[model samples]
Target: MSEPLKSEIAREAEALGFDVVRFTSADAADGAGAALHAFLAEGRHGDMGWLAATADRREAPLALWPEARSVILLGLNYGPDGDPLSILGERSRGAISVYAQRADYHDVFKAKLKTLARLVQTLAEAEVKVFVDTAPVMEKPLAAKAGVGWQGKHTNLVSRDFGSWLFIGSIFTTAELPADAPEEDHCGGCSRCLDICPTRAFTAPYRIDARRCISYLTIEHKGHIAPEFREAMGNRIFGCDDCLAVCPWNKFAHAARKTTLSVREETNNPPLAELLSLDDAAFRARFRGTPVKRTGRDRFMRNVLIAAGNSGDVTLMPQIEGLLDDASPLVRAMAVWALSRLAPQRLRALRPFLAPAEADPAVRGEWLEAAA
Candidate 1:
């Protein structure tokens, strides 16, 4: 496609609600692949074996799709209306990550990406593939190369105009477009993001140990969370945004403009008591269109139990008691921990009766640990 056509495509992207648009060659992501390989080699990704499984494809856009010559990166801003850190102190309520308070970004951005891709295909008569987060595309590096933003010390893409709140999407096209100048790193000497991690998930300036990340613990992890990180997790039931929220660049971010991306009132600071009460069906119904639903009720409740333990709200003791007999050992184990924190006497009183009946070794271990 011609340079003028690329400009027209950028205009169309903005019309489709994308905040930023840029282009880069498929080969631009080769350097980032080295970082991915290194991260995998150090076993920093934790249980997210998918990252290691798709390492080759994710290393470069060309490996994912050889037919593609150009990568069109698009960013949609989901900036919060108020200080995200404010909710962290509200221990009785769950502090969901801001981006997850709205409808799932995959659903919100997928249609828009396809629409833009179709337009590109029609105008340039080029083959196209669209991807949101599900695909194994290294979007942040490609986005940085495309001039959308620079990869900050937190390893997330940070833009001068959009700050750290952009949701990235990629469009791979057979037609080559002139690449935009890559954005220069603007995070010089700023360690705000690295220093703000509750779990010290950032091992260094740009490296993250996902095993300790609350977002990964609450959402991606399938089993019981390790004891060390549970208390540090606090009331963050869905995902953690400490690093992103602390970024100095967010001062320039505007509140989300798209209605679909706007935060749902019910999701903002939801009561931990209410969330802890959600059964499988209720959990699904409550978070239907939001990203929290993807974690499923078992894992979500496990997170809720951790928040409840840290909440210091003895009022949630009844809810914690109720979860002790839950079908999922993950939930039951965390519930035992929550009870021990909120009502140790009650936990001690019930240990004899509970421990004998619990068949699961993990749950029994939780009760045993709490009693000791």
Candidate 2:
């Protein structure tokens, strides 16, 4: 039987637009399984319980599928062309994560992975499966083991070539492909990602307390954002990128190949007024295929209202007026909270509309207190 030519397959993957390619023998990740277990036992995953439940399966690819003999880890670089931190000072605008500024990466990475896998199948005689954060398999450690990169202190894979801007995917197969030598830890003294967290989500050098993570708070957590995090959130309406942006390795980061990920002129720092005007339909139309879809309309508007409140721009009162009777009471309540932060005159002007409106009692109570 002819053995698979791993180097040839990796070249094909690079030609297919994958920035980095690597191969790892199954069970190579067993060494990192202990740290993963400790991470879960400490309840560091927050509400992402799937990470905990699938811990065993994730630590060992064989546990997920005994038929797999090899794992191919691929990294796609989506590094920003400019300093992502520059957007933070534009308080009038929403700051989107660099990864989210373009096409949905899952869609992009999966299609690329599939194309690469298909080419590999034509070259070899084994069955293959492709995944990009969609499976229980631990692609990070596997990528590190395969010499794609090292697991940064932030736990995301980082590379001298790609920085930490890589999006990882994998193709698991029954073929016995030769494995690449693993990369050693390069973050010996770097803690920039930890100190830069606005929410202080990092519990240690490498572990994150997802509950306080801004990405989790703005994108994942439902209901109201906890009061403590509201002020620190600034105007980041969708996700946080502080950890990724502050990494010194990003100096070597490459520019994105296409304008698709370029921040849209309107989206780059969307005026709080315009965002407040979006009803569910407008919100859906504006954000289709974007990562912002994860928040849904109501949650997104709630965040916008918080930003409006923080903007200290009393001129936004008119926009807040429209959302007072918004279909989502959560939005209306937040609107009231934001409006209250403005001049007493602005609050007085909104009293009649807010007083007669039959909104949620909790929200109404908040509105009434603001009126007082």
Candidate 3:
């Protein structure tokens, strides 16, 4: 019963556009809880307090859904066609992460997961619960257990066929399907993922300190990014993908089957000048259905300002100066920093007017630092 049913489910999932389909028992993941606790204890998660908030449910499958006995893990590949790192040399452009260069995968995977979950319910007469990356589900560990891929040294799942580019989704079911053989780690002595980190985010082979990670600083960290990471950030205005792009296993990967998930031009390596010009409404309308919209205007502008400062294109001073008066201090502080870098004299001239009335202490401090 389990054999034929699992095969049928795999076919349907493939038909539904999932690149990889595999199964695992709904058992607790080996050491994910211990790792989570250690990560939280060290304050490595940064401002992502949600990781600690749902620590219990994130530890295991049955902990979240006790009625579950089997888990169906799905991998939807969104690998880029060309070198995702190629844009780094184009310092005047914003190098967005490959995954976020397209439409938001969370919405793309959720619609498909719901469709697949219904088929699983019919095939086994079982109760099913679906989860995407958003939930408390420990997706990478469970994906490894289900034979989708091994957890790479950089702590993301690395598929033999998809490299580190698979977006994981899961269906936890009550049906007793046999688990697939788990994949063993193939990282060997390669430290490309670890070495490629501009901010030295990897504490060890498999652990990451997110607070120092560029991905965290640019996207996750709400406050002003630290001075140390500002230059290392280069022109990556959104998430960083250096580790994933350098992997040797990407040779086997192909471009995504879904065109909607491919790297769209506007979000992929677009010019810093253009991005710096975006107002709140313009930012929303431009990135409407994409992942960039979720980061919202103020934070996104802060990142763009960092890119502008690093660009060495003094032409962006006007736009940087404009943001110095932005409503969000998150934007104004970074603008002050960027202005000092691109046009120190201009920033010094404006400091007299800007610093006195500044209500936000952080922005005022940026003004003082610019003077000193």
Candidate 2 wrongly placed segments (more than 4 Å)? 1-4, 28-32, 259-266, 348-365, 368-372
Q: lDDT tens string, model 2, 32-62?
A: 7888788788876677778888888887888
Sort the predicted structures by lDDT, highest score first.
1, 3, 2
- Which residue window of length 10 is worst by lDDT in model 2? 258-267
The root-mean-square deviation over C-alpha atoms between each candidate and the true structure, in angstroms, is: 0.9, 2.5, 1.1
- lDDT per residue (tens digit) for residues 247-342 in model 3: 999988888879768777778778888888888899998888788888889999999998888888898888888888889999999999998888
- Distance (Å) between predicted and true CA of 312, model 1? 1.1
TM-score of candidate 2 on Cα atoms, chains taken together:
0.91
- The CA lDDT of each predicted structure is 0.92, 0.80, 0.90
Ten contiguous residues with the weakest lDDT in model 3: 259-268
Instruction: Work out how many backbone clashes candidate 3 has.
Output: 0
lDDT of 1 by residue, 1-372 (tens): 489989999999999989899999988464798999999999988889999999999999989998899999999999988999898899999999999999999999999999999999998889999999889999999999989999999999999998989999999999989999999999999999998899999998889999889999998988889999999999999999999999999989989989989788768879998998899999999998999889999999999899999999999999899988899999999999999999999999888777799999889889989988
